[model samples]
Target: MKKDKEKVLDEVWTEDRVREFLASEPKAGTDADFHALLKAYQSMRADDFELFIGMFLETNRNLNATDKAGRTVLSYAKEHRNSGEHVAALEAKGAL
Candidate 1:
């Protein structure tokens, strides 16, 4: 079926904008619940992820937590090949 480009974009743009609007929710602090933590993790870019992990690890938290998808923060570092602070955070998190 031929699709109308404008119609598709209009439909998609609302959700996209909403997602973007809702993306950068600020956590109160280190006690982010598991769901919030997962969303925060999923929403992060590589550098942001590293920074967050560093924050957590600085307070002695482990970043190697498995999500509902059975993926860990280590999984993201491995997937992105990010061999920097993110990796360090994961290591600090006890993520092998």
Candidate 2:
């Protein structure tokens, strides 16, 4: 089966655009910080995720925020098959 949408690998991400992910809000009862981190991880490349982490910490956001299920971004990243670099980035920032 052919997919209708094509994947974009080298999409340009500027600082402003990368910083925008910091404002991502979560659904009710979900952790805001976790949602932001997950969204940034899902959207940005590894380098951009690393850059976002810096800005996230500068704003005093929680790097260890957990979802309703108590799963941190690091926990989720560990489960993802392609998230090795993302996991490393999260760990370097001391995310639990």
Candidate 3:
């Protein structure tokens, strides 16, 4: 489970809050699209992440974007046993 120092259960996720993630940029050589997707996956719960994906797609972002290591967000989620919902969200979006 993700352990946050001050985790807020049942926290509200407004559209603006979720949309803010889209503005995230990566380091010089990192893929910007991939970075945004990865950040959202790491920061959001599966449901919110799914909502973020819809907004991401509306902006024409690449769902299959890979990191320098050639690992997509789905790859990272797959490595975690607790990521069933997250994996389902990625697959629903047709991520490779």
C-alpha TM-score for every candidate: 0.38, 0.90, 0.90
Model 3's TM-score against the true structure:
0.90
The digit string of per-residue lDDT tens for model 3 on 1-96 reads 976688578888998999999999899999999999999999899899999999999999999999999989999999999999999999998999
The C-alpha RMSD of each candidate to the native structure, in angstroms, is: 9.1, 2.2, 4.1
CA shift of 78, model 2, Å: 0.5
Among these predictions, the greatest lDDT belongs to 3
* Model 2 error, position 75 (Å): 0.2
Q: For candidate 1, write residues 1-96 as lDDT tens digits.
A: 876664332232332333342234444542232333355455554455545554555555445545456666566656765446556655765666
- Badly placed stretches (over 4 Å) of model 2 are 1-6
Task: Output the worst ten-in-a-row residue range by lDDT, candidate 1.
Answer: 9-18
Q: 1 or 2: which has the higher lDDT?
A: 2
lDDT of 2 by residue, 19-90 (tens): 999899789988889999989988888999999999999999999999888889899889989999999999
- The lDDT for every candidate, in the order shown, is 0.49, 0.92, 0.93
Ranking by lDDT: 3, 2, 1
Deviation from native of the Cα of residue 54 in model 2, angstroms: 0.5
